[model samples]
Target: MADKRPQRGATLNRESNRFNLPERTADGDWLDDQAGIDGAPPRLRTSVTVERARTIISRNTSPDIGFDRSINPYRGCEHGCIYCFARPTHAFHDLSPGLDFESKLFAKPDAPALLRAELAKRGYSAQPIAFGTNTDPYQPIEAEWRITRGCIEVLSDTDHPLTITTKSDRVLHDIDLLAAMAAKGLAAVALSITSLDPRIAMTLEPRAPTPERRLAAVRKLVAAGIPTHVSIAPVIPAITDHEIEHLVERAAEAGARSVSFIPVRLPWEVAPLFRAWLDAHFPDRAGKVMAIIGAIRDGRDNDPGFFTRMRGSGPWADLLRTRFQIACRKHGLNRERIVLRSDLFRPPEGPQGELFG
Candidate 1:
């Protein structure tokens, strides 16, 4: 396998002031083919910064999502999934939503302490808190920062119910903490596997672990007595949609207890990013691929309506849903339906009110 690094205009350090395109432009300047730059490509370098977050509890009232509160210990994932919906968030920090979104990462070092403080609040109500809802907490940077692990330690200590959604297998590194939480029905994990094809997975989520490795992680988590689920997320039409059944079946075989899926979403800048990715990797089928996506998204590159956003509305959407349901039934996954119990929540001691009382 080729290194797959030095992708287009991406640079690993500060000295490389000039950017190079996958292919040169007509003007002799480096043109970033991925960003659709036909002229001179901008010279940019990836820089990582850390910010102290005031609060870790993110509240969500959307009827579409399963959990009410979530925590993102990091901002901007290093996994560099082109179709990530959270890419737009980088713009708020004066960063480009393109390469900068992935390379330029930010982590909240104080997340664990803040989480503990929040849980100890007088009015804190216990709901199954979610992790990796915005940016993956287990993204490559977590190894050194340990912020996500620390937050999990807090949850495990307090017996707070929690959920995790991540594409990285690094979650297995904290199995002891997760297993302890799971023993008390306080933890569940959802591994997001976009596709089983290595080639497609590489282009789709360039920095994420291999699909097989993630499945192995699922098996490991299950063997450790942790409840596991698989999310066949961002089901790109005309591309990986064909592997839906196979992927789900494999997940079930790996001991996944539940499964869920979401259609390809091109919210904000993700439309152009995904299109560029398709052109770079699958030039011949980019147009057809996007057409199917638009069909599911109601004739537009994206549909952002609250209810329709997660799962699009149309015949294509219905077909995907039907396929997922059939696969789930075939594998006997999601049949047990073990819902997290909120009644066992106990607020931490000190400034935070008692959660179990």
Candidate 2:
């Protein structure tokens, strides 16, 4: 496979949908009738399908994460990170979690309205709603669809708390909304930065914003008074583990309040996809990389036990934690967790009632 195959990250389109859907195969008959024939398949294109979700907010009781409630404005992230643990979810839609997970996408245009309705429930309580918990809220299509901006507008109008995690610099587009919320202690943001190396970043997360741009976004978000932090998520063992200290230093330079890292987790379909990507891009040390990951994950590809899943176990995990802690101490990061205020929340006027002005 060509190293520079446009901007897509997945190496192959594995048809692993649960229903056992037939795999997609190239058809040269149509190509032959249309143009000068080359057997090479046409470049893949992204397609967005509108998902009119009955509800917008999803609640979870997992012990590993911070927030209990969250929202994913879109499904099937286009950033195309080869190791995204969310990849298995696309299998429910009868699509390949590999290439199809990136090329095909979904948008919830009704998110703002649904959010308003839910918030207006009579006994509803307030808590920080996390965006990009599953898929990115500010993927490229966001520039046109503006679903995330619309949801932020709703949150802003209602004085509700929200947190955003994204790898794209597009979050800066809604700086006005976020900054206003920050002024009231109702907002925070974290940009996921995995590797500082351009080459690794290229194949690892083909379409995400460059590390320089993300750090620049951190500077701008900080300047705007948003409690912006840096998340060095999914620290792929051999591929990106070497850049932990460098990333923390850069995050500090950008004025980030905290810097955190998560050792890579390959839960289901993501494991195969990530392995294929490793074999293709980093063949020299791919075995060593998996060995380290296995060591970190307690001799398994993944450990799904609540707390252990988030903070991997074993000697390698301890080393990563120690290095990250040292880096944070050296840079004075993670001094305090930015706490958003839920007391300020006011439910939006909905069909149920218009109590809030």
Best by TM-score: 2
The prediction achieving the highest lDDT against the true structure is 2
lDDT of each: 0.81, 0.87
Q: Write the per-residue lDDT of candidate 2 for residues 128-214, one digit (tens) a residue.
A: 999998988988999999999999999999999999999999999999999989999999999999998888888888888998899
TM-score between candidate 2 and the true structure:
0.94
Clashes of each: 6, 0
Models 1 onward score TM values of 0.86, 0.94
Q: Candidate 2 — which residues are off by over 4 angstroms? A: 1-4, 17-19, 23-40, 351-357
Off by over 4 Å in 1: 1-46, 351-357
Candidate 1 residue 226 Cα shift, in angstroms, is 0.8
**Model 1 Cα lDDT, one tens digit per residue, 208-277:** 8999999999999999999999999989988999999999999999999998889999887677667767
Instruction: Give the Cα error of residue 282 in candidate 1, in Å.
Output: 1.0
